[model samples]
Each structure stands twice: as structure tokens, then as C-alpha cells.
Target: MKDDRCEGVIKDAWVEQHWGNPINRLVTKVEACYTKLKTWNRTSFGHIRSLLEKKRKLLAQAEALLMTRRNHEQLRTLKGEVYELMVKEDAMWHQRLRVEWLKAGDLNTSYFHSRATQRNRRNFISKLNGEDGQVVEDEQKIGEMMASYFSELFTTAAPSDLDPILQGIERKVTPQMIQELTREYTAKEVEVALKQMKSISAPGPDEGLHALIKQAAAIGTISGVSLCREGPKVTHLFFMDDSLLFCKANSHECNSVLELLEKYERASGQRINQDKTQLFFSSNTNQQVRNSIKGRLGVAVSHQFDKYLRLPSFVDRGKKQSFSYIRERIW
Candidate 1:
């Protein structure tokens, strides 16, 4: 980017053309500039590795010539050329590795190159489990599977009983909160938001799916087991699509919860993976009740639940034991 020849190519390609939308005009200019830059890089720079090697060989010859003859100017020119190529090589590897904190001019090209290669190897998918539960190794099939999976994951489903669901949820947002949220963005606020964002961070979906499920529990559409005599009832705890549901050890409530899940699947186009889902029962609950509920839900039963978000779902009397993972991570 600092090269004069590259700057000339970009400037030449970025010539203005008439377009109605300013954004479209700008995008067109950028696309043209990128096309020209790629051509310029290929024709002029060639492969960085090969070019660097060629420059090193020439530099070695210049040094030998200088040792015998008094050609100081030629020797200095060759040294400068070699140094420039080395800098470019370092930059190329650094960009691929994306080590933002690593300072410029440190010349750790070999380390960056190795890390980049390792990352590419780790990210490469050789095979994947297809929707049909068979292992797929074909590259094209794997690509299609991934594309279809993510397309469904992020796409919003057809509208469900959203209006009734929203109505069921008690209004918690005050007028002041609404006003503040709806107000036009100020320059200082925008600057603060930009500063708070990391280079790799971007906006994602907010948490609201739990509200509908909570409303269902509140209205007794589904009965949730109590944590304690005074504590609030627990219907479900949700983080993104993952959920942990709690209810009394009875077939009726289990069936009700399964019905709700079916409705959710229909509305959201997201099905629960029964293979990954498990039901954990309280110690006091009878084995017969557990078996009946498990049969109704069509999910396996487990004596204990796995950690949610790397933390134990239920914390007992021994706090240190429950949160030992945190201490281990810190250490």
C-alpha cells in the first residue's frame, strides 16, 4: 500500500463515473481499483518468495564485486533493494496471520508464515457429518452442506404467534427507556460505540426468544419445577439456540413441553437435535417418573447435566468445586 507504483495504479483505476447512488458509485470505483491492483501486482511484483530469493542472490554478487572492485554505489543499491523486499515479505505474512498487536518492522516473517499455514490446515474441512447422519468427504458436497446449514441458521423463520407471545410478556420497558432507545444517534455516541468495538467484532442477534417461553410458564401453559420455596419457577434458561428446560417429573408437563418445542420448531424452522439433548432429573424424583418423562420427551436421561457455557448448570454447597474450571483457566 505504501508503494508509489501501487498508488499510481489505484489512482488511475479510481476515475469517477456518473452513478445515481453515491454508494454504488464508490463501490464501482473500489472494484475497478482492486482489479487494476491485482493485475499490477501479478505483472510487476511476481511471487514474493521467488523475488526475495532473486534479490538475495543479486545482493550476494554485488557484495563479492565490492570486495574486489570499488563499486560502493552498486553495493548500497542492492542492499536497499534486498531490505525493501524483506519488509514486503514480512508484511505479507503478517497480514495472513492477522497478529494485530505484533509491531511493524519486527521481521518475524518465518514465525508468521508457520502460524498462517497451521491456521489454514486447522480450518480446512476434510469431511463432515451430513444431515442424513452419514459421513461426507466430497469437497463439493461438504461445501453445499455448510452453506445450507448456515443459511437456515441465520435466516429468520415465518412469523408465528408473535403478537400473542409479546402480549403475554409483561411490559418492563419504561417510557424513559423507550425514548432513550429510539432517540437519534449523536456524533459522540457513535464515536464511543466505534471505540468500544474490537477490530474483529461485529453486531449479532439480541436475546429475546426466552421471553416467549417465560410467558408460557407464567400463564401455566407449562409447569416448571421450583428451585426453592421462595425462588421463582424455572421454565427454561436460554443462550442463543441452546436451552435447558426444567419441569416437574411428570408425563403431563413433559408432554406439554414437547408440544411447545414442536410449535417452536414449526415457527422457527429450527429443530432440536435429540442426539445432543439430554434430560437430567432431581435426586428426589423417582426412577419410574424419570423413565416415563424421558420416554415422553424421546430424549436420553442422565444422572447429571453437562456444563452450560463452560460453567456448571447447578451449583451445590461446595462453591469452589463447582467453579474450579475458572481457577484452572486463570492459572
Candidate 2:
């Protein structure tokens, strides 16, 4: 059965004109109602009490309105509108509270107050360390200092061409990825993509990489190899059959870890998964060493990050608070 609240059925035909057109659930009056509801004063107690009364009245009016629209095609829409408004109240409060670890199903003023105080302290930028051994308290000077620091950092001349750095690296895409990419896509794919896309107000970034790398890397036959100063070593870890050959940028002592995947695959039927793999490069490794290892393993690039599984994978001497999140960060 069709979803009653959804809009626009997939047509029995396809055409080039449909390429850029947006799909639905199309915009609704309920969405507009939520928009208006959000503009009401929520900070003051008296105003919020009045707003709650107004919301109650609106809900009552909506219930009455539903009866009148029941005989028409707008009956389902009426139900959807009321449901959205009911849910929107909690969502609106949750947005204002901004407590990442808490949900909005329950509302209390004390919890919100504590969260607000925490946010204020977290965002307070009272003083900044200046370049020339001075404390910068002035907001304008601090802003200028940060701007200059970042500008110099980003615009620093490239050490060398990235292509050369990546030249000897192995192919990141796999056969599984190729198969997925070459397959014909239908309306099902389009619908799934639309549904998975985050809303405009979502916390994540606007764009995400939608590469077929997973499917490509999932070929269970492939494995990785590595060489350490002690000797050759292979360590390819895979949870399922999806083998993402993640090569962590480890000590220059090892040539490649994928070699271990090969060793493991040869010794056993299992292949390492690249999806769970994270490759972090070290600063001390020679360029030739990187080129050799990357060329041998088909790894084109390395991203340096200090976290692995929410734990600090690398140490920072400057800030004690960098690792403090680990104490509280749990699923």
C-alpha cells in the first residue's frame, strides 16, 4: 500500500526532464505551522506559558479542522499536520537545549538551565595566547591573531606535488566498487538516497562521500602485506566479509600491513575489511619509505588524525583536556 502521507508516486515512465526535479513528501501546511511556532518567544517563563496555552488552542482547532476535512482528500494531511506539531514541541526545545547526550522526550527547566550554563562556559573566549609571548584579552586582537595564524597555516607553500606523493600508491577502488558503479540504478536507488540525506538543520556536514569503495574493497579474495624492521608482518582485520584494507600510517619500520592480510588469507580463508581501517601517517617517516610502502599496498593517500575508536591514538603535550573527553565518551 502507498504511504498515505507521502507525495508523488513513481511514474511508470522515465524521461530526461525528471533529472533535476525534487521528489516529495511535498511541502505541507503543518511544516509552515511549525515554522510559525518556532518564532514564538521561548526564553521567558510567562511568554512560554502563554505559548503553551496557544499551542493547546491550536491543537484543539486542528482537531476540529480535521473533522471538516475528513470528507475531503485532505483528511490524511490533517492527521499528519497535527502529529508533526505534537512532535515539533519537543524537537524545538531539544534544539534550544543542545544537550548532545540527552533526549527531549522529557522537559524540565533545571536541566535546560544547567546545559545553558555549560555552553556559556564552553564558548567563552576570554583570552588567547599571542605569537609574541603576550596574552591577548581584546576580542578584536584575538580574532586578528587567529585569522593570521590560520592564514599562514593554510597558505604555506606545498612541500611537493601531491600526485608524485601518491604516484606509487595502490588502487583504492576495488572490483566490488566497480560492479556497483556499473550497475543500472532505478527509482528505488533515488528514493533511498533522498531518504538518507540529512535534513537542512541536521548536525552533520551538508555533503558526504558516496563512493562505491566499500563494494570494491569487499572482494574477500584480496589481502594486505607489510614489512617491518623486525621482519614481514600482516595484520588485516575484517568484521564481516566486507574487506576494507585500512592501512594505518604506523612506524616507518613496517613497509605495508596489507601483506599480513595476504598472509592471513593464505593461511586462512578470511580477508581483512578496509571499511574499519584507518591509516594515519607519522611525521618522521622518510618520503622514499612512504612511496615504497604506499606503492606496494596501493594506498593513494594518508589522513592524519589522533583518534581511534574514541581513544586518543596520538598524544598531544600542549592540552590536558584533549584526552579528557575519553572519560565521558561512551556509547
Candidate 3:
């Protein structure tokens, strides 16, 4: 973006004659500028990885020559060139990972590369379960399945009145407040709001879902697992959108949990991603009961849990032994 050639290309593309409607005219300019930039990037910038590798190899050769003969000036030039390419490589990975917090001097190119690769691996869906309880592996079939699933999931329905449901809830916002919320905003306000927002941020927590599950647990509709003799019964644990629901190994509670999930899906217009969902049971839970609950939930059973939220999921009596990985971490 800071390249002089890039600026020239953009200026040239913008000056090109094009006649169209206002929107089309704007799009044409943008498309032309994008094409020019793409070509410029290919020709001038080239591949950052390949360029960085070449620079590193040259640097290594320079260092080897320096060891045999003291050519300080040549070694310094190669070092500077390698450093510049390293910065460029780091910047490329930072943009790919969308990490906004990293500063210019933090040249963690390899770390960023590994993190981006890990993210790609974690997000890629090689297979998907269709509605008919069959696994879909074909790329086209998976795409079609996702499209169909999301289409039905997001299809809007007729608006419904909320007065009856919201009547008992205390009003936090007054009519005047509503007017303030609905009022038009000036350009300055929009600019300030946009500037204040982060490049990426986590979504707000859903307290309503927590309330609904808590209500179910309160009414004994769903049982929770008790960790110790006197510890509080943990019905459910939530972090962002991922949830861990604890319930007894029984058919009745399983059905109730499924009903609650269905209600949540209907209300929120969001369905659970079965690909990432899994069930873990205590050692005392027999194979027969595990199989029954697994069939009912239609989620895979996990026999081992390494970590959740960067901490060990299951800890032993010896705290030091359970937390040895903490000491093993790089400083």
C-alpha cells in the first residue's frame, strides 16, 4: 500500500474513461484499481515466502564468507536486506491472520505462519453430516448440504407480537430512550464509531440461553453432575458459544436436554455444529448407558479430553503432576 508504483497504478486506473450508472461507475473504478494492484503485486512484490527464503540463503552465505574473510560491509548489506524481507514476511502473515495488536517491530513470521496454518486446519470441514444421517465427503455435496442447512436455518418467518411475553419484564428503556435510539446519526458519529471498533472482536455473551438452561435445571427437568460431595452441582458451563452441559446418565434427562436444545435453536435461528460437538462421560458411566445416551444425542463420544480453554479438563489429586505442562511452556 505504501509503494509508489501502487499509487501510480491506482491513479491510472481511476482516470480511465468509463460510462455507467453511479453505482456501476464506482464499481468499475474499484474493479479496475483492484486488477491493476493485483498485477502490480504479482510483478513487483512477488511471493513473500520465496523472496524471504532467498534473502535468508544469501544472508547465510554472506555469514559463511565473513567467517573465512572479514567482509564487514558485505555482511551488513545482506543482514539489512534479510531484516527488511523478514519484516515484510511478518506483515504478510499478520494480515493473513488478521492480528491487529501486533506492532511493526514484532517480526514473529514463523509463529504467525504456524498460527495461520493451525487456524486453517481447525476451520476446514473435510466432511459433513447430512440431514438423512449420512456422512457427506464430496466437496460439492458438502457445499450443497451447508447451503441447504443455512437456507432453512435463516429463513425468516412472519413477525409476531412480543407484548405478552415481555409484559412481565421490567422496562429498562423509556419512550424517550427509544426515540434517542431510533434517531438519525450524523456522519461524525459514524466515523467515530467505526474508528473506535476493533478489526475483530468476540461476540457478546448470550445471557438468555444461560437463563433458560438454569430454569430447566431449577425445575429438575435436567439433572447436573456433582463433582464432589459438597461442591455445587454444575448444570452447564459456557465460554463464548461453546457449551458443556453436565447431566446424569439417564434417558429422561437426555430427552429434556434435547427439547431444550430444540427450543433454543428455534428461538435463536442458530443450529449447533454437530461436527465440533462431542460428549464426554465419567469413568463410572457404563458402556451400555454411554451408548444409549450417545445414540439419543447423535453426537460422538470422546474418551479423552486434553484441555479446554487452555487448561486441563480433568485434574488429578496431585496438583503439581496435573499442572506440569505449565512449567514446560516456553518462557
Candidate 4:
């Protein structure tokens, strides 16, 4: 009994640490079992069944880890974590079944089986809420609240000035601004813009472009460049080859960063192509990219907000062409 309890505790710790990551834990367990089997020279069906049972128990234990603590508050916290894990597991198992079916040249069988499994899992989860009427309703309310909060917080705002700028550019350059100029810009233009921006924003010639590129190349090497709830959320600012600034606030930090960039552009003779700028949410790829450029010149890197930038896109060209050819043709 003590041994079982210890096993349970260890399993729970593993699940908690992994945030109930089943597929990865299962793979690791399977690998361990295979290693043991090889050592023992056990190649029987019974051995395989035993290994499978052990893996299943590990997965069950992981699920059980989420099932502990029955209080409303505790359950609410666990519910979110468990739900995310379940979604991830569903995706993973579906992928696995598809791969296996493809390997066996039984695509139809795999598809139906995966679909059925997913349906059953969903049903089982729905049924797990027990007969407590209030619990179910409360949980639903919490879920709705979370969804609404995320929707409000992460929703992208439409650029208020974009239309006017495009119109002005259309009047100046291309006639069919929306249609013709959309595809005109190339990747080369983006590269050039990045280079020019870095050069202008960097503190010195030695540390400007070269240092920024190096930092971008070796992103993970830097400390303090991650998303943390308590850390400064603001990111560094970039302008049209003149100055870089950093800003920090509790929220909407990306806007502050963009504002600084715009201010720098206005101070300098350079103009920002607002239509081309994009805001990248801080993900693994983007964090690396952001870390690489942080402090290259005067750029400050923080986790305050999502990345925002104006880059050259085909839309501006289209707007120009719309003004040039389409409007002219229509007029």
C-alpha cells in the first residue's frame, strides 16, 4: 500500500509538472518499458500487454492528478488545466491514429476510428461533471467568463488611420491603390526596411545592425526575454533609422511601443509605412526573433505587449494602382 501511495504521488508530481501532458508521458513510459524488455530479453505478447497496461495506468494517473481537490475554487483551476490537456490529447491521439492508419494503408479505418474515439472522449468528459447541478452551471459560467475575457483582450483593433494614409498615398503615387500595389512589394523590400530601421535605431555603428542580427540569431542565449506575468510587459521601439525607445505599462504595452516608433519617425525625416507593420504575438518563434534584436542599439526588449510593426505589403501597391489605373479607367 505504501509503495502504491508513493507511486501515486510520483505520478501526480509528474503530471502536475507536465500540466497533464499524456502523449509525451506515454511515449516516455513506452520507451522505458522497451528498454527494460530488451534488458530482460522479454519478447512475448504477455510482456507487450503488461507494458501497455502500465502505460495506460500512467495516463490514468495523470488524469487522476487533475481529479484531486474537490472544492469549487480548486476544481475551477483544475478544470481549465484539464480541459486544455484534453484538447491537446485529443489532437495528439487523432494525429497518431491517422499516422498509424496511413502506415497500414487503411486511411478510412483510421479516420472513422479516430473520429469515434474523439466523440466518445468528448461524451465521457461531458458526463464526468457528476449529478451536481450547481457545479456544472458554475463551471460553464467560469468558462464563458474566460472566453469573454480572452476575446476582449486579444482581439485586434482595426487601424483607424490606415484608410486615410492609403488614400493619401493613392493620390500621390499609384492610381489603383488597393488593387495594383498589393502585390508589388517583395521580400527584398522587407529585408531592406528591417536593415534600414535597425541601422537608424541602433545606438552605434558597431552594435547596431551586426549586434542586432547576432542577437536575433542566438535568441535563447539571452535572459529576461520571456513572457512573465510579473515582468515588464513593454517591448522596445523602432523607428525609421533614427531612434529606439522602450516603454513599460501594465497593459496595451504594444501600443506604447508603436507610439514610440511613430514619434521617432516623426522626429526623423523618415516616414513609417503603417500599412506594412504587423503585430506578432509573443510565441516561441517571435520571442527568439525579438530577443535577437533586443538592445542591439537602443532597443529595449520586454514582455509588456505583442510585437507590432509596419512592413511593406502588397496592399499599399494595390491602393496605389487603384488610384492610378482603375480610377483613371473609371473616370
Give the CA lDDT, 0 to 100, for residue 58 in model 3: 84
Top candidate when judged by lDDT against the true structure: 3
Better of 2 and 3 by lDDT: 3
Which segments of model 3 are wrong by more than 4 Å? 1-93, 105-177, 200-207, 225-232, 329-331
Ranking of predictions according to lDDT: 3, 1, 2, 4
Any idea how many clashes model 1 has?
0
Error of 1 at 99 (Å): 7.1
lDDT of 4 by residue, 68-104 (tens): 6445554455555544444434443444344323332
Clashes of each: 0, 23, 0, 40
- Candidates 1 and 2 compared: the better one by lDDT is 1
Ranking by TM-score: 1, 3, 2, 4
The list of candidate 2 runs beyond 4 A from truth reads 1-93, 96-100, 156-168, 172-331
* Residue-by-residue lDDT tens digits, candidate 3, 103-145: 6787875677688889878889999886788999999999998
Q: Candidate 1, which segments miss by more than 4 Å at Cα?
A: 1-113, 129-135, 148-156, 168-195, 220-235, 239-241, 259-275, 302-331
lDDT of each: 0.75, 0.48, 0.77, 0.42
Q: What is the lDDT of residue 272 in candidate 1?
A: 69
Per-residue lDDT for 261-331 in model 2, tens only?
Answer: 34333433333333344445557767776776656655444454445556565665645676666566752
| Stretches > 4 Å off in candidate 4 | 1-107, 110-112, 115-139, 154-158, 163-331
Name the candidate that leads on TM-score: 1
Give each model a TM-score. Answer: 0.59, 0.35, 0.55, 0.20
RMSD, one per candidate, in order: 6.3, 14.0, 8.2, 27.9
